[model samples]
Target chain A: MKKMNNRSDVAVKYLLISKDGNALMEIGEKSAGIEKQIKIDGYDIETIVGFPNIEKKEQIVDGIAKIIELLKNGEKIFNDDVLIEYVDMIINEKSIDEILYFTLKHIISSNLAEKTAFFILNDKLLKLRGVVYLKRDNEDIIFENRAIKSCQIDLSNRGKIADAMFFDKVVTVNYSELPGKNIERYFDKNTIIIPVYNIKGVVGVVLLEDDGTKAKDDASLRLVSRLVSLGINYSSITKQLKLSKEDVAYFKESIEVSSTLTHMGKITASVAHEIKNPLVSIGGFAKRLERYVSDERGLSYLKIIQSETTRLEQIVNDILTYSKIFNIKREKVSLYSLLMDLEEFFKDELMIKRIMVKINCPEDLIAYIDPRKFKQIFVNLIKNSIQSIENDGEITIDVERVKNGINIIIRDTGDGFPIEIIQRPFEPFVTTKEAGTGLGLSICHKIVSAHQGQIWLDNYDDGAMVKIFIPSEGEV
Target chain B: MKVKKILIVDDEPNVARLYEDYLKDYGFEVKSINNPHEATNEFYMFQPDLVLLDVNMPDKDGLTVLRELKKVSPNVPVYLLTAHDEYKRNFNALYAEEYILKSRDPKIIVNLIEKIKE
Candidate 1:
């Protein structure tokens, strides 16, 4: 509470600070008595409005980091309500990984260093998840090896980096000052390692190269320090309050899902291998036998066997490929050109089925995404529409530009999705065709999701409809 | 112009035969060998402008053979043919001229080879 005295009515303290983080709770208990009376130079005042200090520091460095992040992007955040919303959005999330991802993005874009490596401690697993970001050709690239790999570190590690990680303290060292030869490999000549900690223990560490120039100023250092500290505290506090049990349950559920997917992929790959081997013979011999068939009846029958084998091979291949890692290679792909290419490729099939195709998109519609994955999404949706349609059916594709992404609607003149599983056709092995392996939509779902897009089955009286929305630059 | 020669190394006879047949139809001289261990020997004997090396082999993994083949004929362009699609395939195919999925049509391989030859 503010100490109002018979001194001056001219000054006021807007944000009040206390020992604990729960200043709002404290204000709730004291606001009743303070609001009733106020004495300033023997003059009565009308109001003593106060907001709680949500941070403990010599100065309020709490929201400054967020303000810096916002300002760096040229965003003007002036309204206090919007500021609180931003603060709540920043501090409320339970996932430290999400926060770190954004922080790393901001740091990289800030161009503060040549290389940065982020490590988050897994208290349950006793290991460090290493994330490395390198600035290459003016683009931030996550070095693949260090991005996917985890490192085991303890206090026994000799270098200054190990000191920072193990001791839960920040350290800076030069190339020559690095302790041992083995430890020398992990770091550059000059590095600053900072450890992030909470009430429980060490939570994360970030390594930044000194670059021999660009020495960090005091304000920036304090901001980084406080941001790290806040991130660690918020994550742990949220977990303690609401997520401790659910985290374990969610982990168990994901393990079950991934393990099941792995088992299915393994079996599918093996089966694809076994079938692919003999399929080569069957397909090769059928094409070879085409020369021997003279009569029209014999030739047509041989063609059926030939095409069937090819189709079967395709199904097996699709299943195998679907089960594998969908590595995304993003680029700026023109949707118009992609559609033209797809139209050309499918021309023969469309002719065979006697189907009419129409593309309702801008002449230069473009999106930043992996073209292959994008193609996969549209192709699967097209195929899903195709299978539902009979001969002479029509397929129309419409594209619309949304706030941050593009929305595409593919509608077909076939029976709409079955009423029961219409919502879950994206699930693996959910198909209407007798020959379908059911991985088509699932693969499409995976590819779309990897591109940070959403795919869903839409209902229309005319036929089956599938809608897709992909971000302009694959940003989520 | 001398006809472009192609070397196909695969464990599966039908696959090798399929590639051999398709490339020959495209008017390129082609040889099919099953054992990967014989790739280096075949490379010297065939002296082909291009080599189609299959990743899954019995005697030696395709990458090892690729290393040995590279040591012998450093400039002979090699195209990786693999049914497996894993990123670990990244290192194996890093040095190759191109990596083609075997599950794709044999025409794609022929097209890539002809394009490279041109």
Candidate 2:
């Protein structure tokens, strides 16, 4: 057996003996005499292998021919049908992680590497999640190492690797010349890192390390890049599936609630009709009785009937007012104008109840809202407050602009809502008052949500406060 | 002027009778129908100068009847009777002469009818 001295010299000698043997001989003229001297020094002639002087030339030629034949057979075997069958096996696998594990194992086996790992990118922290080794005996492949540090290297200056991966592409660190960071904490001693990217963005990385020099070859890097891209595409498809499931759930809930509202609307309309006809008859008869009746008892009874009929009318009005849903007609409305209109409409009621109403809104303060809907919202709030307070209680309406939005607060000297009612005051059929329809605050909530605003009730020590926050027009 | 004969169409007999008696006191010859199905024939036969139509009926909705009345006599003024205030906007869209809330005192309706007669 002949021993080879110095691997580099062996590689050079093999290259010189190849197709460019004559050119290499001219370059080796200076060392020609040294080769002659080595022959005289009793070096074994059979051990002295050169690129051009091959002892087993015929065997090498035969091996190459066989490899070519095998390649052609492999191509025929993987014709479209076979290729599709292989792809279906990978795609139908229960988990993508299992497919990735097998793929990493295959790469390490084919490349004859010491170790290989696949790290999936964590979107939340922009970091690696797990490491899958190919043949290495490291059982803790998926363990998170917090001590690992990363250093960003600018490859733009290096022309060879400049456009290899785009600017956003992650490059693997050469462990031998690792940059000034705790890079070794992430990978083995001799590893090559390659980024994984899908159409959307970079999703993961692949690391290959080995004792052999072939691990850093360009061909190996290119093969690993293609596999990473396939893995990233699979991950993105999974993410889209999750989002579609959530959307389906939300759509079902919306359909259920809308149907409930439609049924309620129909029932209310019919009941209102039944109640009104008899009410009109009673009012008409009461009016005629008042004209003919002279006794105090008879006159008082007629007055009672008239008052009761009026109360029933108010109840019907409230029901109708709360059930209607209107689209927003956004327009710039002055707070001063709204307050003035409300004050005029409620003036008589205020006088009769002896409630003192005060407005503290700014004259120039403006907000964009559906005027009709907002009018009803504010009126309901104010009326509820007035009804809660005792006779002579004070009510104040104030509007102010703050932090890119407008806040309208209505405060009244009334006993605050009970603790139980306060928690879910905006829910339908939740009322504190004897004559409450329980839909007042629910309607208010729906209106505020439609306007892209918020309405909340605050319980103060002395009174109750209702505050409305509406985002300013043109302001997100 | 034949007192500008008025027709009252409602599903409730008592409601129909109330309007008929009240409008008669105001010197108007009023015809009334409690069944909405019979409204189309009676409406044309009466040749009413104005019609008071109730919005909620068992056989047919008031809006359908309103459309039929408009086809029969587009020029004749029709007033819709809605018990609920929520229907006010919908009533406005019907292009009726006016909307009469049923919850209001019958005296208001009598006064409104007299004003419409003018």
Candidate 3:
């Protein structure tokens, strides 16, 4: 205003006009370290002449360097639209290794660090199960070491990797500063341990190593880690969904077969007694004639007649068993006691076949079921297993409690189910054996269904396996 | 003490004949009523020590016959012998002494009847 003679104030005005076209500025006083305004042409300017705050100058320089880094990062990210596109395109990649290698390669190419690695966690054991590492060298190459892949981060022994997982965030650590830290072995410089996580929690960790001076954008690194998490989670979800779909399809088919068998059962139940009465008469008459027939030929003929009638009787009984309907009278039955009774029941057959029966039931385990019907299932299953095994084999009945249900597994060291029969094992009149009415598995299916349980058959390498899962409390 | 006289009510003729033959062979006096409608009359006429009743019949169900027979001779033990076991849960069947499946061998029935004392 009055022919200002301050050189620093004039320089401030020129700088503001050149940069922002605004001259309202404040500068610190050299002695007081307090800000004051200097007006020029209806505007103010900033002064730095004898300002004694050397800390302020260093702060400005640091601020400028950060801005420059931000601009450079922004440019790199713009060019990395391809990375975003690659992430979007490779999301459906079936093999996670391919995606991990591609991502590690891309990250290494970005020059964010001297080295990049992805450490995948084995969710079961909480250990590092795999690693995909990329490093800058004479030629760009991605490699993995079995030893590094097996590295287990001892969370108790806190380090950058453990902190990243425990805090559920990115952790930066100077490798040289950490004495006796496990993470130092992996990196020769600074490390940014970024956690890869999803709704299920931290599934993996990402290690970014660089010279201590290189700047890292934590937010961008987090975004990349998230993308990697999404890829892994997507593939796992896809596998589970595929298995669930197959299970649904299988149950749907089982239901259709059950409905058809129910109709046949209804028809069979109506006439079963009508057929059984005559069988009893014929068998009774054969027995009566057996006393008078003295000749061996006559006796043999009578035996044939008696045996055929008995066979007919058994067929009718089997059919009626299949058609029988009863409510699932659920009660808390001691499974250990029930299995023990079955072991006693088949004691003779088991001894005859020289089969070792192993009942792996926890004594305290109890299930809500219709005791009689439940017993019938085990009887039929055990008998089938005994018949399948010729001699000197093992039958294992393992029972365990699961989420909302009880699982019963019966494995027999015998010829597995014929492939054709395994497909429709629960269908009525389906049998792999000769002379049976083929209603055993059908009866088992019906009984399990009445309890709103699931029974499936599988063949192990050396034997047949029957798996049954029912709610702890019977659903029906 | 042995059961001297018994009655069997069943709709099936051959099944009744088989029971009759088997019971006769066991040396117990026995009567067979082929019709459930005529069961109460036969029960009253026979005044037997025990009655064997079938569950299913053409004109009248055996549970109703069982109720009538119990009304006539409340003290006489009635055993339900039926091909179908569903009737064992019927309220009328509670009056019966035992529920035996008809599919059992006739000799088993004979042994069961012989175990009854009068």
- Taken over the whole model, the C-alpha lDDT of each candidate is 0.64, 0.61, 0.69
Sorting all predicted structures by DockQ, with the top scorer first, yields: 3, 2, 1
**Candidate 1 structure quality by residue, lDDT tens digits, A1-476:** 23322321111222222322322101112333343232222222223233122222211233343334433343232233333432343334536655555555445555555656565665444345565443434554454335334343432223555445544456777745644333344555687777765433356667667777665653454345445556556554445535555767887778656566678778877888778767866777677778778999999988999889888987887877787776898877788889888888788878888888899999877677888877877787777777777888999999888998899989889877876457676777776677877888888888888877888886798998888888776442
iRMSD per prediction, in order: 15.1, 26.3, 25.9
Best by TM-score: 3
Query: Which pairs clash in model 3?
Result: none
lDDT at residue A451 of model 3 (Cα atoms): 86
State the lDDT at A456 in candidate 1. Answer: 86
The segments of candidate 3 whose C-alpha lies over 4 angstroms from its true place after superposition are A1-262, A300-311, A472-476, B1-7, B28-33, B40-51, B70-78, B108-118
A372-459 per-residue lDDT for model 2 (tens digits): 8888887888888878887788888888889978888889888877775688878776887776777778788889988889999978
Instruction: Please provide TM-scores computed only on chain A for all of the candidate models, following their numbering.
Output: 0.44, 0.42, 0.45
Stretches of candidate 2 off by over 4 Å are: A1-266, A289-295, A348-358, A391-393, A473-476, B2-4, B43-50, B61-78, B84-99, B105-118
What's the CA RMSD for each of the models?
21.1, 30.0, 31.8
Candidate 1 at B100: error in angstroms? 6.7
Candidate 1 has a TM-score of 0.47
Compose the digit string of candidate 3's lDDT tens values, residues A73-144. 443432434443443333233467767766667676766777877876654343554477677786756566
